[model samples]
Target: MKTIWITGASSGLGAEISKQAQSKGYRIVKLARSFSTSKMENQNIISVHMDLLDENQVMKTVKYLSEQGLAPDVVINNAGIGIFKTAWDINQQEAEQIFRVNVLGMMALTGAVIPIMKEKQSGHIIQIGSQAGKLATAKASVYAASKHAVIGYSNAIRLELKPFGIAVSTVNPGPIATPFLKQADPSGSYENSIKKWLLDPTKVAERVVRLIETPKREVNLPWWMNVAAKAHAVAPHLFESIAGPFLTKK
Candidate 1:
């Protein structure tokens, strides 16, 4: 069975993906601060406490895993945090934390794992980005910027890793109904506004499983959002005029 390591596997999309991957017979090593394996019956499952903000711990975990011959065939960089506030309203500290977790942390873990995968000449790097990565919106200023960085990084590395037979892919999904919403919007208004359109975590997990089985350069979930992103790209002024009110609820 192929081994897979996932970050942010404690909840939401990461948790769902971990469960689904285990069901598919992959040995899974789940990394997250809140992760637990007490309920899992699978002997192949390993849970490690991780805080992406701690670079030393991140490096130590990956190094130990690699040295022990437990390096995974696939490494999923899914750990992230978001703050929903306008550019002006978002504080410097909040923005910095967002970038630290969503951007810098991803790079740290990826950097640590790259050499092992490169030496083996095979592996997959799956990044869970967001639709916000492709298009900018009102209140998502800082969050969008972080994801944008993720997309650009993934694309560049994809090309560099191709010759080594390693695959790099990113998943950009629109609003998913998870703790993410409550975490992003403590007031719950944002959650209420977009609840109906939210994608199910289970479905997203299925898509991830398929990606690991058959690597793809990128995937944009719930197609309509991709269309909207393109529209924004072509006519930013016009698209924003119509989309602004609906997207950024005060």
Candidate 2:
């Protein structure tokens, strides 16, 4: 059976992904600081305690997986934290934590797994990015920046790992109906504003899990969002000017 490693599997999209992947008969290694057997009632799922903020813990988790012959066939970098605030309003600590969890920690975990993948001559690394990364919006400066880094990193590694038979895929989705919004926008204003547009967590998870069988360079949810991102790339000023009111919802 192929072993799949998923971070942030304690809740939200991550949890949904785990449940769906397990149903497909894959061995799941769920990584999260708060992950517990009680929360994950599947005997086929292995819960590993991982605090991505600590590089040491990431290394240890990888080592344990290796020692136990659980080298992942696919590693999904799904763990992320976001705090929505204007660039000037976001504090230094919050900004740094966002990068640590959303970028550096993800890189550390992926870096550690690369060698194992290279040794096997095959593996897939999937990054959970955001549509905000493609087109930055007001009040989500830092959060968007972190996701932009994820996309950039994923793009580079996709080329570098191609010769080794490894694959890299990035799933960029717009606002999802999950606990993530509750934490990112504690005020609930943004959630309320984007209620109709919020992507379903289960639906997004299904799309993410599909990548394991048919890997792609990237998958942007809600086809229209992808179209907007492409349009923004071509004419940023025009897109921003026209969508200014919509962009400020966050």
lDDT of 1 by residue, 104-137 (tens): 9899999999998899899999999999999877
Task: Give the alpha-carbon lDDT of every model.
Answer: 0.90, 0.93
In model 1, the runs with Cα more than 4 Å from the true position are 36-41
What TM-score does candidate 1 get on C-alpha atoms? 0.95
RMSD of 1: 1.8
Error of 2 at 92 (Å): 0.6
For residue 180, what is the lDDT in candidate 2? 93
- Model 2 Cα lDDT, one tens digit per residue, 13-62: 99999999999999999999896422335667788889999999899889
Give the C-alpha miss distance for residue 144 in model 2, angstroms: 0.4
**Total clashes, candidate 2?**
0
Pairs with backbone N, CA or C atoms under 3 Å apart (clashes), candidate 2? none
TM-scores of all candidate predictions against the true structure: 0.95, 0.97
